[model samples]
Target: MKAIVKGALAAGVLLIVGAGIVAGLRGSEPSAGPGGAPSSGPPRQRTLTIAAASDLKFALDELLKEFRAKHPGAQVQVTYGSSGNFLAQISNGAPFDLFLSADAAYPRKLAEQGLLSDDVFSYAVGRLVVWVPKGSPLPVEQRGMDALREPAAKRIAIANPQHAPYGRAAEAAMKSKGVYDAVKDKLVLGENIAQTAQFVQSGSADVGIIALSLALAPAMKDQGRYWEVPLDAYPRMEQGGAILKRAEDPELARQFRDFLLGAEGKALLERHGFFLPGE
Candidate 1:
């Protein structure tokens, strides 16, 4: 009886050891990742790069925060500049997953050139404003574009019309108000709408015709005041974007595009002073 009990105990110990050995072997093997590839550790994160208009600076920043929260494994990067300059870069084969232009025209041009992976979709309508720093004698809020004619408004700033849509819009607004000829000599050109705001903020220019979005941003909101330019003063600034044909991650880009055109995005844009597509 003693020998039988000893034999049973030995067998049980060997079985337990064998099971641990089997488990160890299985653990040592690499796991499969997305497409049945041997994964070393976690899944590789996806990257989405966007070329955006400078007018979207404040608004897009907020949108990206929400995007990252929802897609923990996705990484997003953005470059802001004149939409036309981005168009030129994209035409020349710049690597961007998406292009968010200040107007639909630039992206449509890309689509025409067969540079886009998808159709251009409008996201928002941009508004322009005549802005002046705090404590300025010019009553921009009272006189609107007429304030630019004041002798104290010697150095007026605007985005460069040659490449920036907002700049062209600013020029059009001034022209519509019959102030273009009076202030053309005093007009200082910024490379983009954001820089145009910066010019006035930094005292580089006395006043600026800049995006309403910037004027409402925390950075500039308290530093200055603005009077909205009438919608009829210039051509409509319908902002839009498209996925690039050379996008490394087209699916991810599409997801982001949907989000931008979604409810949350529209709310944030509206808060930042951008008008919605239908309104």
Candidate 2:
């Protein structure tokens, strides 16, 4: 009986020491968070960086908002500029996860250079417009590209043809309409289509050749009127995008690319005045 009692006492003391050791260790540990993981703090956010064409500002804004709602963990950063400029930047190793170009040729060029992680895919067909502020008497809606030659239009704004696809389109449309030679001396250049629209809006230029998407944006729509440039006048502005070979997260870039190509994104782009690829 004594031996049995001694054995019980030893076992009980061992149990107590074991329990105390466990309690001490638990006290030393960080408290478990909601899912029983040590509370290291909030989970790290997944970041996606995109270089996009200026024409997509309004439409991409809404699309990104929807994407964020769907992916709360994702943080997307976008830089908008001329497609050619972005292409140069990406080629020089700019840290962009995705590149959305106003012209597919830019992305195709990147693909040829072995810089793209994925195949170039068309997103929308961009169109140009002759835009003038509502108060301006340019008659752009009636005369179309011909209005650029009007006496009242002392200054006409267009993106720089050297780098901007829209600028090239504007030049082509004017040339096609036989107005290029007449108004060539009156042209002002913007860094991109958005800036071109700003020139007309601010009265810095009497009229602007800009993207139809910009002319349809809420702010631009309220302040200006526009006429769609004839499609045949300029080469088709088939916009496209590609994932970068150096993307920090290729899968995340791909997911966003898929979202942009999805039906919801298509509807949003259409609402912003972008024509769908098929229609």
Candidate 3:
């Protein structure tokens, strides 16, 4: 009986030792990670991450959704901000796979700095508008810079020119109209086009100059009306896009870039009041 008990204990110890050896071999063989679990499969095919200017917020998203429908495996995530800021991020290694600027100049600068793919493209032309909220005494089209000049227009809103093309365009228009000097003191700046629209609609500012896309948004429809700023008043808002040179998934970036310039994408941009260069 004592020998039988000793034999059983020996068998149990051997079984435990064999299991440890099996586990160590499996771990050393790369079949398992250091955590002693099965190794993860191949790395995921990364999605394209685009950092676009704020004005392209909605239009770009609508196009992205369309692209995703056609290519279920590929994904696109958009981060929208000022063109200038987005440009800086590209320079500082922001991990943005692509950039779509509110103006072409930034993309051009990126290309000149060798931060962009060889094939940068002009995707769309952005338009600026002078907008006045509905039910307000101010008339948008009839008033123009004159409304901004009115004492009633004490709080006129425009985007910060340092950041937004629409703001620069509005500033140029103000200068062209010879109202910048008079209204500059009254100008309240928004960080971006979307916020500029909000300043007027919410009555935080008496009036605003914002992107046509925002003015055309359903929420803004009842809230405001806008007149397209004359193109000559400012340099063309030539929006451009490119895949970043440092992108880990450059082909995915290229696919998104092509998709944005394609027929469906162009139509989406047009539907939202963005004009093409050829248009």
Structural similarity to truth (TM-score) of each candidate: 0.87, 0.85, 0.82
Please give, for residues 30-96, the per-residue lDDT of candidate 2 as tens digits. 5578889788765545778888888888888778878877776677788878788888888898898
Candidates' C-alpha lDDT: 0.83, 0.80, 0.72
Cα lDDT of model 1 by residue, 20-99, tens digit = 00011112235687899898795555778899898888788789888877776677778888888899999999998999
Clashing residue pairs in candidate 2, if any?
Answer: none
Q: Considering lDDT, which of the candidate structures 1 and 3 is the better prediction for this target? A: 1
lDDT of 3 by residue, 1-279 (tens): 000001112221110100000001111122555788866754344466778777776676567666666666565566666788788878888888788888888888888888876667898888878888677777768867667877788888888788778788888988987888888888877766666766677777788888888777666766667777787887788888888888877876777777788888888889998999787
Query: Candidate 3 deviates by what RMSD?
Result: 20.1
Model 3, runs deviating above 4 Å: 1-45
Ranking by lDDT: 1, 2, 3
**Runs off by more than 4 Å, candidate 2:** 1-42
**Winner on TM-score (1 vs 3):** 1
Better of 2 and 3 by TM-score: 2
Clashing pairs in 3: none
Q: List the residue pairs that clash in candidate 1.
A: none
Candidate rank order under TM-score: 1, 2, 3
